[model samples]
Target: MSPSHHGTEPVFDVTGVTKVYTSGEVEVRALAGIDLQLFAGEIAVLLGPSGSGKSTLLNIIGGLDRATSGSVLFNGRDLTDFSDRQLTRFRRDHIGFVFQFYNLIPSLTAWENVSLVTEVARDPMTPDEALAMVNLTDRMSHFPAQLSGGEQQRVAIARAIAKRPEVLLCDEPTGALDSKTGVIVLEALTRINTEFGTTTAIITHNAGIQQIAHRVFQFLDGRIASMHVNEARIAATEVEW
Candidate 1:
């Protein structure tokens, strides 16, 4: 049976999800019966240390990985039941991903790099529009090598959002940048969430970043340790690294 749908439902409803990896004789359980809900148009921060299963869950929700057991419901549809091809389609149509590493093509200009996704996207914004959203319109003609680390990352963000994915999953997006640059990146993400009403989930080990989230999920030892809502959320610029 599918999850019950309601008038106001979460974009993602993850229930009893688990991931177990087997390597020879060792069994590593990355997630242990995780039950979580990500509401629409809200920013959620998954705060945890390395190997705490935050990224594991994010991958599962983004259709990049599957749960070993249990179900992941996206808009009331079970993603766990989707085939590989269906998963690819789901990701293409509904999910955007960002990571710590800025994976920009060195040979392409920022505009060209973002255009790569816009070309195939069903209903994507123009590359110029995406770059403007990330405050990189001025550097759109520059190549990855010509830009700073933060600029390259913003270009990557423009590429991700160019496709206009409903959900934006970011894993350690600011892990490699300096505090100042990280704040700038955070501001871009916040602006995207606010302007486009994108359902954003950001995974970070930095506790200070949680202040910007509408909800915070703390993970430990492959499980959610606690969850809380931010009654007094702060701006991304005010986050203390």
Candidate 2:
């Protein structure tokens, strides 16, 4: 499905963004210079190998990390200029992040894990509603240890969506799961995007997953090598590793 370019303004406008990590005398450039636009309500798949700077760019846009140079504008506001407190609020109020590992508190039930976000969000769905989004309402009371890996990931997704974020940033969300289980997680992600019209960006090593996105970006050596619109997007179930 093609994403709706509802407005001329992009959700995220990244320009000349670069990231450099320093350790002692060594300075490693993670991002050379990135110029990208993430439109509102679009599913963008970033494909690259390890150390390709896809994750670094994702982190910068998500407000998890700062760029060494250049500007990152979110809805016309310059994120790179924001104070630490403002960045924290920006992440909490607008961005939902899902990492490769399901970072659930083992002691917390699925419902509780999701509730943790709803409790702090400005306008959040109920934990029940979030669990229902992932088709995990029946397992809401189960602990993470009792659930399978896919189930745990779904719960983590539920927690992220509970806050009704405007943007969902996922870094290798399905990397830890098998092909069968990964598709299940992808289904949940696509469903959420369709339902909420959330601007979603996913970084994945699985090139096949790009077929499910509205647009695909190929990263190489800390820069975007190529980008294209997927005119004939497929469903999550149709994606293969």
Q: What range of 10 consecutive residues in model 1 has the weakest lDDT sum?
A: 1-10
For each candidate in the order shown, give its overall lDDT on alpha carbons.
0.93, 0.95
Per-residue lDDT for 1-241 in model 1, tens only?
A: 1122357699999999999999999999999999999988889999999999999999999999999999999999999999999999999999999999988989999999999999999999999999999999899999999999999989989999999999999999999999999999999999999999899999999999999998999999899999988888898899887
User: What is the Å distance of residue 34 in model 2 from its true position?
Assistant: 0.2
Of the candidates shown, which would achieve the greatest lDDT relative to the real structure?
2
Instruction: Please report the TM-score between candidate 2 and the true structure.
Output: 0.98
TM-score of each: 0.97, 0.98
Cα-based lDDT at residue 91, candidate 2? 98
| Candidate 2 local lDDT, 84-132, one digit each (tens) | 9999999999999999999999999999999999999999999999999
Error of 1 at 169 (Å): 0.2
> What local lDDT score does residue 71 receive in model 1, on the 0 to 100 scale?
90
